[model samples]
Target: MRIGIVGTGFMGTTHAKGWVETPARITGFCAETVAEAAALADQYHAKAFASLAAMLPEVDVVDICTPTYLHLEQVRLAAAAGKDIICEKPLTLDVETGAEMLRVCEDAGVRLFVAHVVRYFPEYAAAKKIVADGKLGKPGTIHLRRCNYRPKKAAGNWFLDDAKSGGLLMDLSIHDFDYARWIAGEVKTVFSTTVGSMDKDAPVDYALTILTHEDGTLSHITGGWAYPAPNFQTGLDINCERGNIHFDSVASAPIRVLIREEQNAPDVGLPASPLAESPYTTELKEFYHAIAQGEAVRVTALDGLKAVQIACAARVSAAEGRPVFLEPQGGVL
Candidate 1:
């Protein structure tokens, strides 16, 4: 599949590399700024365009790597141009725009995929499989930690602006939100605590949310861009009825997985593959196949929506100091 990427920022560049590494062919890249587009195109060995309109006709797929506020319009443009879409997480900064994006893509008969990278992480994927196979017993409670030191360059930028990026819950914690849902099933309610970002006037950086899933599972997530350093960490611990498992420090090599029973200490497994490819590459390959076959994508627009909804609910719960329900629609439980 021929693909056109919009935006030449960090995520844009990362996704471009991922697509190139995947089976799809990179047709071109477009950035609002011509210089950025040209630079990325040169690096990726693809054509460069000054605008989305210039690249749409030449590519079968449009990958949106733009900021949150720009997603709705860019997606609409791609949809109208009859190109499949692969968008970054938190499809848009708000629910209405996100829903509209899905609607337009659906109406245009274009597949919509979101980049929820953690879902593709090898350790997380293995954890999900183990849980599905009942090896983790009945998933009872989960504790997750996802955090990073915000780059000084990005600390007070548009990413921190609630109106522009929807702050930390939407911009960052959404990953953890998606993973929690993926592993444990539907979320029923949440109570949260949040603090304004250290460097910005907006609220994008810090939060701790406690989620209650419909299956009587409790999950907790803590995320932020306030580390003030370059390192980042992510891990999840699952406590089941009969056993427990943990996947920790997955971003680096030798990812660890710990398993234990009621009477045992634990068994730890390290990375088995010496040269494992990145999860981003795997995710894009899946997107290519899903689009080609007109099949449901691994990271569907609804999954993105559900994640955003949970994040928004968490935000409300945080601001109000109360638990918020992940309400059923149309009286359907």
Candidate 2:
């Protein structure tokens, strides 16, 4: 498969690297600024295009690594070109555009996969397997935490702007939101609170969200760029009918388990594979397989929509200071 990439920032670079490591080929890299695209292309040993339009006709898959606000337009362009899409998360800054993007892709008969990398993380994949294998024995409740310092500065300029990045929830918490959906089931309601830096003008850097699921499973997520830690920290704890499973992002062994005395402790460590191969590679391979074999993607556009819905509801809850129902005004995609 030949793929074209849009945006060459950190995330774009990560996704591009994943593609490079996959069996598929990276045909072109695009950026609004042609120079930026050219630089990334040189770095990754791929062709450079001035814009998405220039790359659309040359590739089978369009991997959108642009800002959250630009996703709708870029996805729409790719759909119009009849290329399959792999988009970075937080489908869009809002629900309307996200739903529209999904609709466009569906109508175009294009496969749309969202990069909810947590779903593909080795530890997460392991945790999912353990849960599915009945080791967790009917999940009861979950707690997820993802936090990091914004530094005295941000890694990128767009990330600091609320208009482009969707602040903290659309930018960061969506990771946990997607993971929570994968682990705990459907969300029923959400309540949230946010604390922004007094010095920043755009969006809050700190946020905490409580999600109530349909099955009475509760999920709490806290995320921010406010922590003084040197690196991002994330993890989850699932309380189940039988036992509990915990994973810490900061740990060398990211996953761990404590079952109710029946089983011995299991040490979950990151596999000793080459850096070129990771859950990101696994996910990219899945996308390639889906395209090659004409199968449904594991993480569909609708699944992506649901994740955004969850994040949006959390955003509303935070702004309103009340628990908001996770009701899709139109319906689920």
Candidate 3:
């Protein structure tokens, strides 16, 4: 398949590298500037289009790695052209836009895949499999932490603007929110607290959110841009009735499991495995395969919509200093 990538920023470049590892051809790119698109296109031996409309007919699939705010328009254009779409996380900045994007793609009869890459991370994927296999029994409390320095190279410092990037919670913490839902089921309410600034000159920002799931599972998710260095760290702790699973990026062995005595399960310790290929590659390959085979994508557009809903709710809870209860629509909050 021929792929057209939108944006030439970090995520766009990352997606370009990922598509290279697959059998698909990197047809071209459309970015904020022709110069930027041309720079990335040169690295991939591809063309640079001045606009999305100009590039649409040349590619079979459109990989949208643009900023959160640009997603709705780019998706609408691509879907209108009958091109399958691969959009980056959070889908859009709010529920209304995300819902409209999904509706347009559905009406166009084109497949839409959201790139929730955290789900493809080896440790996270393994933990999910364990839960699916009933190895953890009924999960109870989940704690997730993802911390990193604020993006020093984000174009125009967009990451600091809550209006543009949704600050740390929507852009950074959304991963943990999606993962929490994946493990614990639907969220019933969200309570959150935040610290620090959204100012461009601010050095630190942090947010902590508690998600109460319908199944009685509680998820405490923390995200921070307060790290002094340009370091990234993530960890997860899952408590289940019969046992527990844990992962820490800083740990010698990142993944560990322990079962209660009555459960009679052997403990498992998993050291991080060296990757022959990046998880981004694996994620893109799966997306391509699903399109090719006319099968269901691993990450659906609805999953993306729900994640945005949960993240938006978290923001509301933080702003109002109260628990935000979710009302279900067609069994999804």
Tell me how many residue pairs clash in candidate 2: 0
lDDT of 2 by residue, 96-197 (tens): 888889889989998888988778877777887888899668888788887776633234567767788877887888888888888877888898888753
Q: lDDT by residue for model 3 over 155-198, one digit each (tens)? A: 47777777878878899899899999899888999998888423
List the candidate numbers ranked by TM-score, top first: 3, 1, 2
* Decoy 1 TM-score against native: 0.88
Q: Evaluated with TM-score, which candidate comes out highest?
A: 3
Question: Residue 55 lDDT in model 2?
Answer: 88
Candidate 1 — worst ten consecutive residues by lDDT sum?
Answer: 264-273
Question: Candidate 1 — what's its lDDT?
Answer: 0.79
Better of 1 and 3 by TM-score: 3
Q: How do the residues 1-333 of candidate 1 rate in per-residue lDDT, one tens digit apiece?
A: 899999887778778877877778888999877787998888878899989988999999999988788888899889998888999888987666777888899999877899998888887888888888986588888988887755333333666567888877888889989999998888899888887622346423678999999888999998866553434667789889888888667455464445553432111111223445767778888898888876565567888988888888887887777899877643322
Number of the candidate with higher lDDT, 2 or 3: 3
What lDDT score is found at residue 52 in candidate 2? Answer: 93
**TM-score for each of the candidates:** 0.88, 0.87, 0.91
Candidate 3 has an lDDT of 0.85
lDDT of 3 at 31: 89
